[model samples]
Target: MQEIIVSWSRRRADSPKTFTRRWKWTREDRARIEFYRTELAGCISSATFDAMLEGVNSESLLPFIFCYTVRLKDLDLGFVEAGLVARSWFCLGEGFENLRRVLGPGPRDEGFKYIEDEVEGEDTGYNDPDTEPDDIYVQEQFLTKQMPAGAEEEGALWFNVNIGAPGNYLPGLRGVIRLQSRSTIYQFPLTALSGWSAKYIAPLLFLPNLQELEVEGHATIGGLKDQFYYPLSIPLQLYKGLKSKVKRLSLVDGRMRVDDYDALAELTGNLEYLQIYHTYRYEELSPQEYASIASFFRKNNRSTLSLEEICINDIPGTDMVDVN
Candidate 1:
């Protein structure tokens, strides 16, 4: 058995473009252990890797395994790939078509049984697109019924989903919310419609076990066209549930109000890190607003709430704030 570690980056050292190529290794042992270490050390530093390896759930490891297989396809690492796919059956149920193709039919078919059972036994609404659109009440009922029993115990701890326009799948979100409770998730990251409306963001706040969260979207009501305008609804109360356990929070490319900051302070009293990037109506916070925000953090400081670091970027008058 031989172990191989590949450090790959989407960003090339000299070129601005992102590309992928097989790295040369002379090891001849058929069994291989591969590691996908990010070349951008700042993004996933050595300390972060150690923490993840020690504490992250099995579901969270799937993406790393997927990345390893992606970079090392030329090598004969079928057993390793098959084992990862089988272990991550539940997490890979939604999106792994490309991975399935890479693994090919033999190992992929064997792993398909778990997903097949889930698809067949769970509510038909997951597959049926013909369900009524306006009737959220009926949809919620179907969502509750469709969820697998005891799913909260075994669902993905790191819930990351990107919802696009025209075909925003509410049923899928509903199923996730119904199946996984706050106690079951460790990280919840979502990118959706411009504004952080109650309808869309509320379900995610309920994840009490979530330690890290990243919400990325425009806050303007009508999307990019109405960038200057405030969202129709910004429910601060939604942050109430998030206050207990979340340690790191990031808000990116969104319109945020003073009240939103206040709500955030209230939400994560024990937050260790906070990041706000391009987060104002005009995509830059004014000097006065920045002062107000700095003061807000100072005033709300609690002994229990030891905010270790804050990173503010693209805000007109402010530089980054890092407190060790």
Candidate 2:
């Protein structure tokens, strides 16, 4: 966190309040993990684990299999719960969109909207009679902010054109593939393994030169727009589309699940090597936590067969200590 504070502002890195706040959050995270570890230890044997999954009553399929928690809705439905905050760097020509279902769209492309267009008889002022059909435009001034009110969804930023009168229509988005490709995420630890990685990973998968992906930390949120894109959602497509081009994947302190490995099994089939290193001490983790890690790999056959080297608690996939 000293590095994080320093990076926030080199001069202000020494501030006591920032450190205090981070320390506070870190303590909370540690408490949360401890509670989760207790929950995991009480779970029934791995044999009956799937039976428990069937009993979850929530309609939303995601039960979030945490680095500490053991649960998943299904592997085939492609809901292998988001694992952690991921930090990845992509090399260009940085796009590899060969799949039948492509990334919806970005700032410069026309795309989906959260709300449907007006019915045939109804009128929405967004449609301007004078604008050319091919040349799309919207209220640019309205879009310069974080997000224009109603634009929510995967393709919120996607639009074909940027020309539009203020208040006439909403035109642009805050974050985009073009901007993201150059800037990149994972620069900061907190964001890389956590918030809104799918937005960036979508563009990275489109890159032709893409190969390796390294996930650091027991990340929480997976998809930004929908919360199931990384680890499982996009990687599922990577196995089919990227073929042998994308191979090497390293989980530093991964607390992955069967569903996760099941989704990643296809890609792991081509994996040739495994390297493990302890970024932090293993004793900090309880026996149950170690069991969680073992259970993750044990669940998937394809993933188990693919690894060349692995050790229990030898690598730093969970970096809570450093962050805290």
Candidate 3:
């Protein structure tokens, strides 16, 4: 089968032309067509996903748009150029909605079981008395044989089974791709994204397991002052919503009012680590900026926060001058 990313892009080809289209079809599609003309219907991956995803991390799915979704435990848009990050998040937010329509809303119950037991040639139990033999043949061929590539575009479905539950029925960890449940995502760190990227933060609620979040200065909730960006109440609501389980929060570069911390302090119940990071130029920081940054740590007594350690610009490997 084609890599899911390439297949995903190709799937969008028929979608009403937008920007004349940047992403489309795939190498595999053409490769399949060539093979068919040359009499070799298709090829196969000798290497299996079971071998590949043994210890997959955020880096494993790099450059794949799927990496940006809930499958990734940590959502770090800071790596991309700030301009492109907006598009990345927007596409991701939209992708989730599209997938939700297929997978259905609510939590994804399918466990991400990368490791699978050997079940080759076992009776899959998919061949129920009610199931037609033709349906059974399709299921068996999909798991056993290599079909032609462009065949899918021609309305040829190699494998049609229940989306979530593969079980021993689907039969191999070799080419398995599991869509992660809502509980898979935990850490979401959003840098101060400009323009529309901040608006897409509302989708974070989709990941019910998100715990650690890093909020940027410009992306802070609400516009209590001029220095901060315009009303960012949408993301603020995502972070501070009653259902949120955000534990470790790092506040970076917010030049807002002293009272903003009061709201943030109450966002999480057992906020283990609250770190304040000044991401911009340290020397040029204004007096008012310093107050906005400092006041959060100072006035936390009133909030129901069970903070363990409060870190303020605790950069590693930096020398400190003694003031004694």
Give lDDT tens digits, candidate 3, residues 263-296.
4443445454566666444223444444443344
lDDT of model 3 at residue 226? Answer: 24
Model 3 reaches what TM-score against the true structure? 0.34
TM-score of each candidate? Answer: 0.35, 0.28, 0.34
Among these predictions, the greatest lDDT belongs to 1
lDDT of the candidates, in the order given:
0.33, 0.27, 0.30
- Model 3: worst 10 consecutive residues (lDDT sum): 155-164
Q: Model 2, 1-324: lDDT tens per residue?
A: 000000122111113222211011133443454554356443222212221222211111111231211221111111111111111111111111110012122222232222333232121233222332322223232122212122111111111111111122211211111111111122222222332223223332222333444433332233343233245544346335333323444445432333443444333333333332234421234545444443343333234323223334553324312211
The ten-residue window of minimal lDDT in model 1 covers: 73-82
Candidate 3 yields a Cα-based lDDT of 0.30
Of candidates 2 and 1, the better by lDDT: 1
Which parts of model 1 have CA positions greater than 4 angstroms off? 1-205, 218-220, 223-234, 238-242, 279-282, 297-301, 304-308, 314-324
Residue 19, candidate 1: C-alpha displacement in angstroms: 23
Better structure of 1 and 3 per lDDT: 1
Q: What's the residue-level lDDT of 161 in candidate 2?
A: 15
Candidate 3 residue runs with Cα over 4 Å from true position: 1-23, 26-78, 85-206, 215-228, 233-243, 254-263, 282-308, 314-324
